[model samples]
Target: MTITATRSTELDQHRELNADETAVKSVRARIAEAGVEYVYYQIVTLTGRVVGKVVPARHLPRNIEHGIQAHPGVVADLQVDGSGAMLAGSPERGECVVLPDLDSFGVLPWDTRTGFFFCRMYEPDHAPGDDGGRPVPIDARGNLRRVHAGFTARTGLEMRSGIEPEVTWEVPGLSTEHVPGTPHTMYHLEHMERLRPVYQKVIEYGRALGLDMIEGNCEDPGQLELNWMFDHADRTADRLILHRQICRRVAREAGATVSFMPKPADDRFGNGCHHNISLWDGERNVFVDPDVPGLHLTQTGKDALGGILTHAAASTAVMGPTVNSYKRYLHTGQFAPLEINWGMDNKTCAVRMPANGRLEIKSPDSMVNPYLSHAVLLAAVEDGLTQGIDPGLPRTTGTGVPSPFGSLPLTLKDALDLFAVDQAVARGLGSELADLFLRLKTREWERFCASVTDWERRMYGAEGC
Candidate 1:
């Protein structure tokens, strides 16, 4: 459906809101049945931040039929790419419509009167003569959908994945100072019990938000690792986004701050969102190759691992998207990987075959955008499978052996450089996305480099020669 912009002075006058009849009916039913008074129409920005406009539940009809209007360039608010410039030039562009995914309508467990819906951006005029009016090109979730479709079409297989999201939280009065949970004592039940009320609420809200909420353990001071049932790759990615939102909301209500920053502190253990993956064909677990000795992952598994390893450096730009993410990779013994290698039940390697059929990529951190990360890995795996690439030996030569695929990227800059030059990643993520991402990250790197930190000021202040 098309809606002419009421406020034309700000941007364009036309808007396109695309939704089908069935979706509209479903959304309407949910709003009434759930007694939801307000609905947040949300989208994920390039920085993985959730930003959007909220509409009254009374306007569910309008929003479902003709998506709510939002600033066209909001998704790229921080996306400074190619020309070493931010998206400021196109700031005044007209509003774009965000079509709500009816399937995503869920009542915020913490607040029953409010509901939330994830949306996809589309240009106003999808006319034949219109040049720029199309599906928002930078939509990571949309891009992942496209990539997943192509992979399924080509290989007749689907990927299943589970995410172990480790996040840290701090309470208002009790946990004033940021510190690791009792120094190096991992998974202590006492820590979990100490914060039982806070985490219990998290689990409660998580289930209400449609998450499976398998279990959670205290990883460090104020840090907890939560698990949910795994599902199809795309679905799992969606769940991760919801999972993060739930954690934050729950923490806020408890008068605490929750963070998914990969490395919130330099000395403590960084939060890692490790990806556990497997491939399937129909009802069969193709990844489980009983004929293969030892690890038992099939040839298909090897190829996928090979593709991932081949693009390990470039994928780091997505897996570990933030500047602080690099801090997690500082050492080998810290559970974060320093080298690009796959091993059997080895946490030190980039990819670890923790179970018989499931493989885990330890490179990604809590900072990753789940949609983009899953898309990148799927594309890399496809590249490997299609070309029949081998992932080399399983690094069975032991923990101290030299890295076969060399060292993983240590910083956002290094990852961006490798990502920019990698044709495979370019093809995987599409040139447009890869270029835009590089631009945004380059700007981040520039900002970081330009900033003078407290440590820098302290150390170099006295050395003014």
Candidate 2:
């Protein structure tokens, strides 16, 4: 995905730290053991800076409920400035806050803090304009909330999601490319050995943290998938984010680097995070059609699929947000969709309905922000519904459309240029964030453009320098 050059900002790098002891006692127990001095969360703005920070601990003393209703200025602090630097504001730099998200608290395996709670930052009523407000625009979590609200408001249909993230293993001595396509290695054996223990731990952590969590090892070598037990949309996305960090931390301790990059290697398979989303109406599965032959998706499913396919090109900047992500699109006549079309059970189509209610978008890989990307997907779906687009004649195979989808930006330069004029996308992401996202991504593109790679140096020799 690309951004215009006008929007870069600085960011912080410090790792955020938050601890809670659900097993031993509560937030109180963790504090007694490790000193409940403060809780930390990673702050990313729709626009502006994205950083890691510790938030005000005033809520810690006030009680758990107050912690959930954190103030807006502090929530504004959640977003990093345009530079990607971490924030060290006075409220965030010092003091312990009692974080109480029963659904969010978990002891990350690698970090081993015993208790970590992903929180909702809030500002005091007297602190700013829009009393008791939060950085509403920056809240990716809020986007999910609205999505859930949209579903409920429309059809009493609620949605739950399970994110499938794949990875290629890499070590200090070996490149990630070497491991994924290694013909000599046992099938998916390496990732399994490392992930099983973490899976068990996630189960335990899920119980304590009130997370609906289930861990599964997929068929891909060195790749793993985590499924949160079905819940409301907000909880699903939250668990997915925090769970990913937990997986990364645990894997690091196992002497491996795990990345959600769209394509980690050219020789071997690439990694993509396929999200499994199901809608439930009360206790009934709204997506399932048992009697209607071959699990034919209902009309609603088709519309949702249409939303994804129609917006695939425009959504590429966010869905396939990273440069490495495009590599996954190079389909080798194998399983995996690179094109922006939809077919029934077609893995090659960007959007697929494995069944009538099972809506799957294959384009979202490991690189982009899950929360943000999912929001965009919902926005696309919203558009499809509002626009009454029909996903006619389901396809189950790649159509081999040689032409590029609306000329996808091949590099950072291309992305920024396209993003600058993507009015529909800009409206969905909102003005502030759209500007910030464009600016930051644009800056990164320039960083690449202004530099010389070894390939360029070798080809041009001394003249290039």
Candidate 3:
């Protein structure tokens, strides 16, 4: 029941099986009622990719007790460099056990006969810990839980978040033509009608998978942003991953390719995964109504902002996560943050206080792994709280913001460099995870730097100048 910063083996499979007895009975009843034939035992990788195994529902009881086997590399995207060399570790290395989080079991609404459950991974035949079989260090889900537990233990507060995920959909060779006065548009009802079928399916499937689908709207030419009710940080992260899967499934049937790319096109607004966060103590919102001035956020909220802004530059490596991600930040007027300042109800800063109760981090793109994002923030906030970190005054005018402190790292490379050396971030993520993550991302940046791109060709292809 407890997750520590150093070890998570405190949760044993047998212990989970015992604690999940009620969940087992409930899932079994639902399985029989729904006639589910197969169940997928899945886990999210460091890059937020869903990977897992499929087993017949008849074997559910056995799987619940013993779990399934998966290669360790998959937890790190089974990454490869430009030369096809594995980045984190060899694919031929040993495997790990993937155990189901019983409460996460849900029937796939798209196909009622099949069910799914998100899993937490551990080393093969080993109990999770520093001495025992350690939880896979590169496993983002497990790491997030560890960080969340540490935060709760230190502060006795629960973090809650609601995520706004925006993505683009494109059907190959589709024409712009539509009925007169029904042109493609942003926030127009007619355009919503045009995309309704696709998103409707997404919403339906999302709700079935426990998304609590609240609403959605068209943002760009082919972009849509959907929202869901907020919950504990861990559950919200799981739902975000499931939301991506649901969107992809819905888009596939419509014969369209879906992209969570931060900047899918040069001329339009990029897709962003904005996180709205608040903290709770029992039933009360601790981030609100302390009668603080300016944004009216409590001292605790300000401390959290201080921690987030302090770690903003280093954290961008995960929040943005790719070369193209920085492109979205570089553009002006796209509502992307180019600086690390926090502001009152302003979308231009990296951390925005949109209301008195919570803070919205604007830097995370659609590609972010919610687990990592939340974990890093938890670490930063914990640091702020323990050290009594101050967030400084909110920037009322964009021009009045000071230089250097106000800016974030300009590129993935810069972000990685900062992440590698930051003691606070390293301690937050655990040295083992922080080192492996740096290796994975450094490999990505290296690959991008070595590749010759269309931009290079366009600028250099003219006859020798």
Give the winner by TM-score.
3
Using lDDT as the measure, the top candidate is 3
For model 1 the TM-score comes to 0.89
Model 1 steric clash pairs = 11-94, 12-94, 81-439, 180-221, 181-220, 181-221
The reply for model 1, stretches above 4 Å from the true place, is 1-24, 78-85, 126-133, 172-183, 290-294, 397-400, 463-465
> So what's the TM-score on candidate 3?
0.91
What lDDT score belongs to each candidate, Candidate 1 first? 0.79, 0.56, 0.82
Q: Model 2 residue 306 lDDT? A: 67
Question: TM-score for every candidate vs. truth?
Answer: 0.89, 0.73, 0.91
- Whichever of 2 and 3 has more TM-score, that candidate is 3
The true-versus-predicted C-alpha distance at residue 236 of model 2, in Å, is 2.2
- Sliding window of 10 residues with minimal summed lDDT for model 3: 174-183
User: Worst ten-residue run, lDDT, model 2?
Assistant: 7-16
* Candidate 3 residue-wise lDDT, 1-465, digit = tens: 987764435346444663566778899999999999999999987788999999999998788877898887786787876688776668666677777888888998878899988887777655333535557777788888888887888899989999899998875554333344654466877667778788888888887777888988986777889899999999999999888988888877898888999987777688999888898998899888755566587888888878888888888888998888998999888799987888888777888888877899988999999998898888888888777779888878747647345677789999999999878888767887788788888888888888998878877877523
Worst 10 residues of 1 by lDDT: 9-18
